[model samples]
Target: MAVVLLLVSPASQALDKARMDAAVKAHLALFSTDDIVEERFAQRASAVDLDGDGVEEILFMATARCVGANFDCPNELVVLAATAGAPGQAGKRLEPDVLAAAQTGYGLAGSEQIPGEVQAVRVLKGTIEIAFLAQQDSPVCKRSFSTDQGRQATTHCPAPGRHTWTYRWSRGKLTKVSS
Candidate 1:
């Protein structure tokens, strides 16, 4: 899947909770799924001025069923921009193109669980920081089974590596400051 996310500012705006709630409900309505509920994603929503434009953007993480036996759920970080409609009319929901598709959950990779998860997402200075644990290969261990007459078993134990994707808005476009 082509996944992307956008964000800005550590100092999030104190948006109208009622308005944000309504926006979240409206946004969730786009997906017709009996299994998904508004409250499930609402609590994770926030408002940030990603472009420094007076208007704020909605940031939320969408999650689904577990991706691994350990119940590691996958998350899609979504950013919704408010679009102005006819004068005096409510703005339309516009999902702005995001900067990166950083991994945010664990998955099975050839019998080994690849470590991945979003540790934290925060705005620092004028940029957004998405801290996560990404997948990386571990050293394979070869064990000799004495009871099995020299039979050997290979095992892999990987430690998730920490990573951060930093982004900022410049010239009406989202730019990757670092990763």
Candidate 2:
């Protein structure tokens, strides 16, 4: 009689807590975990010396499944940055007005096509910048809604292909930055 033996190896993983937290914050900003039926997602980061401080800044990308009624939305991309000591703790969320300004500049409102994921985030001159892509390839539609207080603004995109969106908070208000 003859016997055979096989060995398996576990997948390799990176140990970067700061990068992970930035990705998670981005995810929470985009998609609320309050809903049922969890979605699959992934995030990665690349370190670069943006400044001459000899410290490496992180540029991260996050992708996740969209939460929709029919499950027909596209993936999301988010780009963000965090300091070296503690991840995400140093970065400030974007304000609704700031997001509105950016969206207005991009001409994305009232059912525009926006990127589904956050592709990158960076810190520059003590400020945080976030970059993202839209879902629709054609003319994208973007819109914004305002409340009575004028302190909060909600942005929306109506891209049929993509299923994810992004949010930014600043000064204690949350606004939809991209979708």
Candidate 3:
């Protein structure tokens, strides 16, 4: 009897850096120079499949400063995922959607602040589970009486902190599985 050996390389299963850069660039279009965004190798894209479609998704973090000192602002670490698609662009060149994005921002007021620091991603029992710590704000409501309005309500500030969350892929996006 003869014994045969097979060799497998780990780097072969890794993600392409060029593709990751393209996906990150596409996502950066959503923010302007005034915003604070972190787009780099936060984690390995090959670690987990974000969309459960056999293809991998890239995850990154971003931040935006919308409020001033008086506003009830919370520091957020935005967790973003990019999927494979031809999402649609208005540029002179062709840009493919290589990630999944949701509820980031559009340079407007009263937008949702979802920032998560990606800790780890694990594929358990064929289910992709992502672990992260995101921002969560709880408003401190205050009530006051006024002559003109009789009663008024005001939200002074929101206590935001990094909360642990477990998210999964659903419908081409990362949905909160548990927090």
What residue pairs are clashing in model 1? 10-123
lDDT score, candidate 2:
0.38
Taking the tens digit of each residue's C-alpha lDDT, what string does model 1 give over 52-143?
76666666655443311222233445565654333222464434311011111111111111234657878755576767675542211112
TM-score of every prediction relative to native: 0.49, 0.30, 0.43
RMSD of each: 14.4, 15.0, 9.2
Candidate 3 residue runs with Cα over 4 Å from true position = 1-14, 32-47, 65-112, 115-162
What TM-score, to 2 decimals, does candidate 2 have?
Answer: 0.30
Model 2 segments more than 4 A misplaced: 1-32, 69-133, 137-179
lDDT by residue (tens digit), candidate 3, 21-138: 5554555454544332222222333424444455444554433334222232332223334322354354534333322322221111111233344466565543445444433432
Candidate 2 RMSD computed on C-alpha atoms after optimal superposition onto the true structure: 15.0
Stronger candidate by lDDT (1 vs 2): 1
Tens-digit per-residue lDDT, 1-179, candidate 2: 89988553322223256644544444434544435324535455554433434333333443334333223233333333232232222366666544432322111111112344445554544233455544442222323324575544224545444344444433322245543
